[model samples]
Target: MAFSPASYSQNQPVLDALSRCIAACEMCADACLHEDHVKMMVPCIRLDRDCADICRLTAAFIARGSDHAKHVLRECIEICQKCADECGQHQHDHCQQCAAACRACVEACQQYAG
Candidate 1:
């Protein structure tokens, strides 16, 4: 699909960041499921799923040059921040990785939002 030069250039970093965040959330969710206290991890798993879905949707919106993408991206930033805060409470490596990803996404999204 052809993208307008302005939209394509503006959204490149947002798309890249969103992709990384999605991958991180998916991986973290899988890891959380594998934890010994899988039942106790229900909330984290849910948030991870939510964050991943938003990131994916945000990327799609930006790619399609949707006018409402900035609004969606703002919401995505909020969700990523919440997910990161939640994931940071864990001691597992997966959660740590997820926290980092969330933080990175937050910064990227903030840049786009500004």
Candidate 2:
């Protein structure tokens, strides 16, 4: 579903953070693919994509005010944390940025999930 921040006014911060995290993860994954030792970045790339997907799903849940949003957000927090850890291990700028974004998302998700 198309996500609009205005439609989910109560969850606006969480949605905004999710959107930023998604963008950062996508960029980081693409950059990882271009790295000289792409093999070493396999985990990072995978986690980046996973985190982005989870964030997207979480946003949708929150937007719809679904009964499962808390459950989905719990999973979202885990994936975002894993992605941040993996990306933080890398020295690349994109990875660093993605890690930061994921961290922000995690905080937002936590607040919303609670």
Candidate 3:
């Protein structure tokens, strides 16, 4: 029983957003580590990691049609928002991109949860 998101009508958007967010967060975190003042990006890096992990878990829950998906989505939204806020504080290209991705994920998750 291979789980395919295509079988779930409304999950595609949320899944797409989550995947994008995960990629963006990972990239941002990696880039932040390379910045000259890595110390300044501690919060952003932490949030990015947390957001990516939660997005991955949320995507899995959604893909499996778990009863707890909604609960997990609520947490995902919170973390995504926090990550976005932290990323938005930075002017780096990756951070800005990550912020946009996180915001998109939040919107998608909210719609899916509704």
Candidate 4:
């Protein structure tokens, strides 16, 4: 597979942030599922799922230069912030990592969206 910088050069920051957030959300969700008290991590798991989905959608919208990118970015910021807040409450390594990634995503989104 040939890599093409021209394919995504325009909105690289948003793309990079989305990719990081998606990976972080997936990792956090998997980690939460492994905890002894799965019930307690349910909120974190749910938020991770939501955040991952939105991040993917946002990236897709941006990649294609869709007219709805603005709307998607708006939603992405909210979800990322909520996910970060939830993850920040936990002391687990995965949660801490996820919180940091989500915060980074928040900053990227703000730059592009606001």
Candidate 5:
């Protein structure tokens, strides 16, 4: 993807980090849905989906070189944090892995959002 940033180099790190976060979120969402207890995994599944969507949009915003990328980054951080908290509640391996991914995404997004 090409981003038309006012200053390209300034946003490169943010763009890269957002891309990783989006990938993680998508993987985690898929993992959660594969869990045996479908009913208990509902919230996790939903949050994972939400987080994935936000991360993707944030990446696209940054890629397009839009000045509004910061706003999406902030929102993505919030969603990642929430998803991490929810996933952290479970003892399953997938949940634990998803939580870690979300936390990483949160930190990365926060750094860029600033």
Candidate 6:
């Protein structure tokens, strides 16, 4: 299914954070793939992808005001934190940016995760 951020007008902060996190995750993954030691970055790449997917789902569910949005948010925050931690271990610019974005996303998702 196709998802559109334009449809989500409320919770602007959360929406924006989620969007940023997705972009960061994608960029981090691509950067990881291009690294000389790609094998060593497998975990970071996996976490980035997982965090991005959960963030996207959380935004969609929240936009729709789904009853399960909180559940998704809970998972999203956890993955965001994990992704940030993983990315923080790397010294690449993409990893650093992704970590920062994921941290911001974690804060944004906290309110709704309750």
Q: Which stretches of candidate 4 lie over 4 Å from their true place?
A: 1-7
Off by over 4 Å in 3: 1-7
Residue 105 displacement (Å), model 2:
0.3
Whole-model lDDT values for every prediction: 0.88, 0.92, 0.93, 0.91, 0.76, 0.89
Comparing 5 and 6 on TM-score, the stronger one: 6
Clashing pairs in 2: none
Per-residue lDDT of model 1, residues 1-114, tens digit only: 234767677778878888888998999999998899999888889989999999999888778867787888889999999999989999999888898898899999899777
lDDT of 1 at 4: 70
Tens digit of per-residue lDDT, candidate 3, span 49-103: 9999999999999899887887888999999999999999999999999999999
Candidate 6 lDDT score relative to the true structure: 0.89
Which 10-residue window in model 2 sums to the lowest lDDT? 1-10
The candidate, 1 or 2, that scores higher on lDDT is: 2
Off by over 4 Å in 5: 1-10
Full candidate order by lDDT, most accurate first? 3, 2, 4, 6, 1, 5
lDDT accuracy of residue 47 in candidate 2? 98
Instruction: Enumerate residue pairs that collide in model 3.
Output: none
Give the C-alpha miss distance for residue 7 in model 4, angstroms.
9.4
The prediction achieving the highest TM-score against the true structure is: 3
Which of 3 and 6 is ahead in lDDT?
3
Each candidate structure's TM-score, on Cα atoms with residue i matched to residue i, is 0.92, 0.92, 0.93, 0.92, 0.80, 0.90
Best by lDDT: 3
Q: Model 2, 24: alpha-carbon shift in Å?
A: 0.4
Error of 1 at 68 (Å): 1.0
lDDT of 5 by residue, 1-114 (tens): 334546577667766766665666677668767777778888888898898788788878877767787777778888989988998998877678778877887876676656
Say what the RMSD of model 1 is. Answer: 2.5
